[model samples]
Target: MRILQIHNFYKQAGGEDTVFEQEAQLLRAHGHTVEQLTFSNNDVTSTKAKLQAALGVVYNPQSAGIISQSIKRFKPDVVHVHNFFPLVSPGVFWVCRKYKVPVVMTLHNYRLLCPSAVLYYDGRVQLENVQQTFPIKPILQGVYRGSKIETASVVLATGVHKLLGTWREKVSKFIALTPGAADLFQNSSLRLRPEQLSIKPNFTADPGLGAATREAYFLYLGRLTEEKGIRTLLKAHSIKPFPLKIIGTGPLQALVEEYAAKNPLVEYLGFRPREEAMEQLKRARALIFPSEWLETFGMTAVEAFATGTPVIASNIGGGAYIVQHQQNGLHFSPADAQELASQVGLLEQLPDLAKKLGQHARQSYEQHYTPEANYARLLQIYGQAIGATEKPASATVAAEAGL
Candidate 1:
């Protein structure tokens, strides 16, 4: 099969970018032809560029022309889009409809439902916009990038598309990373039909099992952002001082550095390469995922599971969905420092329980998150999309609606 993948990259690379590349590579390795088209936020640095990007957030004719040319040349079996926020826009979906191509989009984040994309902002999981048609509250509060104008632009774009029935009628299928996420979107203002949504969790290549003997410290591997519950992790450590090693850099790096300086139990090991991070995961007693928001998927937690290390995740969102409490791993209440500390102490006190959970974590990785399993699911989704009837191109409707 020939596939075309499209994505708009953020200034900083993230999990969505990683998943996009990994899936394309997975398809190619399995004897499928793959082509990619990408746009970068790095090009939207200047004031004029930012203004133009905001103006074209709803529809970019240039992007439509480029995709039209690609479709003409590649003649792909299907088009899979990962992200198309500011630059790429929803216009490409209309272009695909004109060409009669099936488009499968992965809901890596909640960009369609929430402007911030994570359903989180102001140091908490903000869900006020989830059910709002225009998301007036988020726009008033400048929920996206702390700029009211930017937030309004995003709201306007999604709102306009929503009114035009683009999300419901144009795309062939939407892939949610977890069942919880699927439910969230189904109930959101998008009002996506049950048949339009498919659940497909992100996968990580196995890093092999860890050493038999584990290290004393617990591991926290991800961006050091407030939404990641970094403050909660620090407070938990204060409640019960345990050897904690943090690996990753973000806005809260200085706070982490200062805390590490004062606390003997905490060790700050800035951003390390993936190989080194995996090595740490293999040796740690457990991985701590205390994200405060509703994450689409916890890739780091899955990586820890692949390394045969159990995770102690906050009992909410993707963390709650992935880690089975007391089975593959443990779950603590979201943002509850005391409960988080208790779970950490429990792991330290009960070595046998930790061992059992680690074994189960490895088993879970094999059963759900392996490349082979993901490939089969991806092919199934693609087949379903291909089998679905294509909606005819309506030039009159497009011009009348001005979409």
Candidate 2:
């Protein structure tokens, strides 16, 4: 199969970028032809560039022409889009429609349904945008980077796309990373149909399982942001129940540093290289994920599973799906510090249970998250999109001949 992959990178590299690269490599490794067209938010640095992007965020003629030319030249069987927020806009989907090509977009976040791209605001799941035709709430609140003007760009982009039926018709298929994410979109006021969406979880390369017994400390790996439940995590650690090592930096770095200083049991290692982080995952007893928002998919939890390290995540959103309670891992209430601390205490008391859960987690990875399984599912979805695109062409040709 010939695949044309499109993506617009975020200012900071995240799991969506990782999944895009991995899926492209997986296709190429399987002897499929893969071509990539990419843009970066980092390129919008200057004032003039930012203004131009804001103007084009709703629809860019230049980007459409570029994508159209690529479509005519490559003639791909499928065009897989990763992220197309501010720079690459929804215009690319219209381009695919113009060229008569199937377009498969991965829903890595809640960008289609919310301007914030994460359905979170004010330290909680913000669902007001779900029923609003115009996402003026996020804009008024300056949800996107605390700039109402910047937020307005995304609001206009998504709102215009809805009016134009871009997501409803232009795109051939949508790949939601988890069932919970798909359900959110389904239950929303968006016009996305049931047949148009498919659920596919993200996968990680297997980091061989760790020893049966792990080190003393637990692990926390993610950006130290408010929505990630960083404050709640700090509050839990104040009790000093278990040794916790934090690995990542964000706007809440000062608070993390301060907590680590005051609490001897807490240690903040800052941002470590991917290899170093994976090594730590292999050594840790359990990965602590205290996120409050409904994460599209928890990549760190899957990484923990790959390392045979059970995850103790909040029972909400994608984390709840990833970490099955009492099976592969445990779950606490969304952002209750007391519940989180208690789960830590439970793991401390039942060391054998933790070890068994770690084993189950590794088993889950082998069954669901391995490269082989993901590649097979990806091919199936591509086939579905291609077939769906071809049928209409076939019907049109038949009508032209009056046969």
Question: Per-residue lDDT for 40 in model 2?
Answer: 93
The per-prediction tally of clashing pairs is 0, 0
After superposing candidate 1, which stretches have Cα over 4 Å from the reference? 390-403
lDDT of 1 by residue, 1-403 (tens): 9999999999888999999999999999999999999999999889998877888889988888999999999998999999998899999899998998999999999989888888887778877778877888788888788999999999999999988889888888888888888888888888765667778899998889998889889999999888899999999999889999999999999999999999998999999999999999999999999999999999999999999999999999999999999998999999999999999999999988999999999999999999999999898788667766444334432222111
lDDT of 2 by residue, 1-403 (tens): 9999999999999888999999999999999999999989999899998888889998888777888889899999999999987788899998898888999999898888888888899777988887665778789899999999888888888888888778888887788888788877877766876667777788999878887778888999999898899988888877545899999999999999998898888889999998999999999989999999989999999999999999999998889999999999999998899999999888888999999999999999999899999998888778778877877434433222111
Colliding residue pairs in candidate 1: none
Question: What ranges in model 2 sit over 4 Å off?
Answer: 392-403
TM-score on alpha carbons, each prediction: 0.96, 0.96
The C-alpha local distance difference test score for the whole of candidate 1 amounts to 0.90
